[model samples]
Target: MRRIAPDHDQLLAIVAEVFREHGYEGASLALIGEATGLGKGSLYHFFPGGKEEMARAVIAHIDGWFEDNVFAPLRDGADPSAGIEQMLAVTDSYFRSGRRVCLIGAFALDDSRNLFAGQISNYFGRWITHLADALVRGRHRPAEAMELAEETVAAIQGALTLARAADDAGVFSRMLRRLRMRLGLPAKT
Candidate 1:
């Protein structure tokens, strides 16, 4: 029987999950092959640069996700609070309520970060920019918007760590609530 290859998106999703779960140094070809049901040669055929290439592909996927789910809504004049809330709700599910590691955070945990510094930096930079724009739309001045955006990102990353360490999602959930307030979103009735 002829072997059928996984498509780029499918293969990358599998590889990206491995990186997210294990970090770059820990995501070996053997593990990736097992996930993709591909042999070493087959996996190599898709990503010639190996783990470095795979990490890059994962970053690309993350960028697209944020483009659609994060930036687009903010730019389209959607209510920033609702858009942000929806995004976090999906994030709550995606990360299993802050139990799963962030792929960007995972990449930063290993030496492989050197291979994809630009992608990682762009990912975070875009987040802050879009978030700050939304804050400005919410009536914050540009300077405060930028500052609040950075603080929101820090709170999010920190909340994830605290949630994981405490083995509870409440920490993350609370941070999201606080983030909503920081945007000057009206309190929920």
Candidate 2:
């Protein structure tokens, strides 16, 4: 009989969730082992470099998802309204899924004392630059777009914190609606 192999992708997904739910420092090897059904030895078998490798993998996964779902569509020459709508749609889905702690944010917080600190910092800097670029393409002036992009990203992240704390999705949704309006897009009726 051919042996069935465990899905590494699935394991990564579970690990990512655990990391998000518990800060990097909080996500112990034992917790990860329990969450992914992998013994400590088994985890090291898959990830020889251990926690840092796993953190980098999670960051890469989220970066790809963000690029594909949020950035690509905005760059497809859609009008500002269409772009904003698509961005909000992505955010709504992300927020609805209850994965509020950003992958990068969680990694940064956890790895604050580690050597990966510079890499995590650069990751977020690039992410914000991507957002600012999208805003510029959508017709906002360079400086205004940069400022608004920072504010929008911060607002969405803050809203997520509040939503999770208050156990209500309204906090994030309200912030999204307000951002759309501030961008001169018609508010969802």
Candidate 3:
């Protein structure tokens, strides 16, 4: 049997999972190497700047995913309400219904935050801005839209943390239900 090397995107997805499980600070080079079955030399060959660079790449990858899947829909969908619904559904699936942690949120709470503050801020800022835009399109006043957007994002992050802490995925599901109600969407059946 022959071992196949992972491509750049595959390497990134594996690295992202390590980061999500262990956080930026906890995901040491050894851990990443072990997870990806790559040696230090190979890891460096791919990410010459080392762990920091790998983290940046992972963040960019995640940001790109949300940009395409979550943010763009909120900004461009023909139906604002439907866009919001898509955002909620996509977010739930992305986070694995609270079974998985948000790597960016984890980094924000860790000391690694200082190293990637700009990327972290942009990821969240864009989410809030786009969500607010969708809300405004759904007939909310600008101020209220901004407020609701912030609230929804905060609630989501909080619910994710709570769900992880309590070991209960239901916490996230209930929060999503409340968010739908707060946003005036029909409850999921």
Q: What C-alpha lDDT do the candidate models reach, one value each?
A: 0.80, 0.74, 0.95
Worst 10-residue lDDT window for candidate 2 reads 106-115
Clashing pairs in 2: none
61-83 per-residue lDDT for model 1 (tens digits): 87898788777777675687666
- Cα lDDT for residue 36, candidate 2: 83
Residues 1-189 of candidate 2: C-alpha lDDT, one tens digit per residue: 653436977778888888887877788999998888778888899889898788777777777777787766665635655766777788779767333766675555554436567666665565567677777887779999888877877787788777778888777878888888876777677
The digit string of per-residue lDDT tens for model 3 on 156-189 reads: 9999999999999999999999999999999888
Ranking by lDDT: 3, 1, 2
Q: Score every model by TM-score.
A: 0.89, 0.85, 0.97
Off by over 4 Å in 1: 1-4
Residue pairs with backbone atoms closer than 3 Å in model 3 (clashes): none
Regions of candidate 3 where Cα sits further than 4 Å from its true position: none
Best by TM-score: 3
CA RMSD (A), model 2: 2.7
